[model samples]
Target: MSTQQEQLDFIERHLVYDIFKDFGPEASLEFHKVECSNGLDGFMSALYTVTLELVIRERKRTEVVLVKFMKGTEEFRESSNSYIQFANEIFAYAEILPAYENVLRTSHLESEVVSNWVPRCYFARFGQVEGLSNGRESVLALKHLKNDGYQLGPRLILRRDHLEAMVGLIGPFHALGYATRILQPQVHARLRAGVVDMPFVSESGKAIFDVLYRVAFDRFYEFYDRQKEQLLKDTDPGFGAAIERLREKYFKQPTQLLEWIRTNSYAADQADSHFATFLHGDYNRNNVLFHYGADDKVDGIKAIDFQELRFSTTAIDLSFFLYMNTASEGREEIYAELLRKYHSHMIQMLELVLRRNQDELTDDRGAELLKEYSFERFNGHFKRYAFYGALVCMHFLPWLLGNEKDCAELSRLFDTDMHGPAFHQLSMDIAGDEANEEIFKIVRHAYEHGYMDEI
Candidate 1:
């Protein structure tokens, strides 16, 4: 009966020895294990290992490969299976680059032509072959990244040049969605089904969403107060009044708000649109990885985290990306430019998808549906829902702001510091100037756009 840590150590050694057996005793191996701490559930820990060896047959060849392992309890084994199945499905459709190959290749090719965006696929599998019963299991794999990098949550915030180069990468992702719709209508439909209505449909899941939404809104109000005062002093009476009205309409009417959410929760299958295609659900700076050149110019951009991929108005993803990533100071100035770039890429993709599936898309009805479901209008139409989005954003903002130490301070105000200082620290970190400004901007935007009135 070895302890979990001891078992982990033994497993690592065994894996290294088994995989690099040809390297003989001279082969070197290193292991690093990081506990999942960002409120992530259902896992023991994530481990990274590096093995170095020289090929005995090819004496001149030396190689170093990295392996990732997901270790978890028996309970997690079931959930891990679901996750593995999902990952396998994604991999089956697209080659697994260390990051996103299609996005990187599309961007690279647009700037400088490339033959193909597909990557060389390696093996992928769950940790347990027999599956966990009562103990823990370790799943592992190896891969090579052409570029050394780390992920910022779901997004890849790599070197600066990588960020800029990503603009081109977006083109190809948009292209692929369009191409899929045209060339493989049934496949596209199936992918859409997989994305929008995947398993997570339990009543408990809905309750969790409700709780998250409430937490998000409460946090938004706390931040919104600062902006209300500022706008009042600045003589923006209309904006101030709108905020008050919105508070009355939505925040004060929690029951009504929940009812509205429940009513609108179902996916809408409105009039057809030609522009519809697979949308990157969580497109943002965080989800994108950039390869940089000298002076921080982006040489390449790779979009990752396709777990939320689904069929929707392209505007949903594009708007979210711009709103979340762009700075507040320059947002208004760059809004049109961003929209232009997004739409241009989207239009090109739509055309390509149509061209490939001329017979399937011959109806032109889909295009009309898309035109009617314009992102700008959708944003305005769903501004109340922005509260929901903003709430989700708040959950991650503390990490983004690099504040996890002030949780205790926040807990003091709440009367019980069950989570101790860490919770307060996170709250304090996220309650910074930038976050406040962003929250206020959203509040003000919602007010001015008449979202408050209808809510």
Candidate 2:
């Protein structure tokens, strides 16, 4: 919608004031432009790399920064709490992550220290313009990881090694979140008030699904029609009856579907809050970035997109990674191994974090907290919370596996009429033999494995 200039203008006005205090006076803008970050990277917002060639101290230097700007149709933004969502992310980087770092640093640990698990956010503000209604004034500027060789792994199904790296990292980091709550309750409460649960369970969060549920399924119907005629018709018969059954059971009637979605999304806010840990909230593949080391192996990883970061149970985060990011093949084959590996990491990290608080939190209290989230309890929690994985995968994989071009086009449609003829065309374009086959496999696996039944 030609809003890049507006975003850049906002950054230009606030750059020196917010970030560059002493050096800004000598620095002059030399060059700047928008770099494309496709829809898969950010569906709810616009992503761009802004390079400012500045003349500082009579020398020319270039600084490349990543930017996330609010994007989506006007109606979608309002319905989904897009403005507030952006504010939530800004809170994560500006307030939450730093407080976490401070907590770990101040802990009386005699062991290693863990860094906060995100890229540095240089500047963040939500809707600071005159009206604040239009989200043009919203932007989050961060240190660009891509410039330093961090890259996104495969889009569709992640390899086993990548999955291992992700679990290994977040497991311990989650412990740190709870550690903060135990060590610094006042700080923890302040941060929680600032962060909002996202995408699925605010007052208006579930309401957006009313419009989106039908739109996505209607697109699926068009995709199914094309597949049946072009491919499945001769290969497999009676597919239509199965599709009709699914539509009647889940698609046509969404009362249970919505309920299942809400309960699993955050687990009805839980009974005892001890079961809750800090969550990456939406820990899908798009939100994770990987770094390959000398042997071409994944040596390190960093997280992106804190828009959905909140405090919740680890069940949904684990389920989202397993279900939404991994391919059906990966999900089926390494699912148990992944779970065990993550539980192991959580155990190790929980011990490490609790030990730091032993003087204040006490051994008896620490033992109780550990008992609350034992591996046995974790397995059962996954059963109930895994439904979140099934729901979001349907939306993520269809767009990601088909084509980046389609996703980019679909992302642009966020600022357009999503139910119009153009959206239908894009939806059709997003369906492919591989994409359709992969997504249906996920749905089939969900049904067969009783993930749907558990909900």
Question: Ten-residue segment with the worst summed lDDT in candidate 2?
Answer: 199-208
Writing each residue's lDDT as its tens digit, candidate 2 over 299-327 gives 88888887666666676687778876676
RMSD of each: 7.3, 5.1
lDDT (CA) per prediction:
0.45, 0.67
Query: Which residue pairs clash in candidate 2?
Result: 73-414
lDDT at 205, model 2: 29
Task: Give the poorly placed runs of model 1, Cα more than 4 Å off.
Answer: 1-45, 52-121, 126-167, 196-212, 235-238, 241-269, 272-279, 307-316, 356-391, 404-434, 445-455
Residue 104, model 2: Cα distance from true site in angstroms: 0.6
Question: Residue 76, candidate 2: how far off, in angstroms?
Answer: 4.6
Query: TM-score of each candidate?
Result: 0.63, 0.79
What is the per-residue lDDT of model 1 for residues 1-455, given as tens digits with 9 covering 90 to 100? 12346534643555445555645675443433323222221122344434344445445443344333444333332432434333433543343232223333433424322212222223233334332222333344433334344233233122323323444455546556655555555756656555523332234332223333344556666766645565467645776666566567766434355444333433454323444455565666655555555754555454544444544445446545545555556555565565555555645654544443445555676575345435564444444343433433544454354443443344333333222344444454555766656656645554554445545
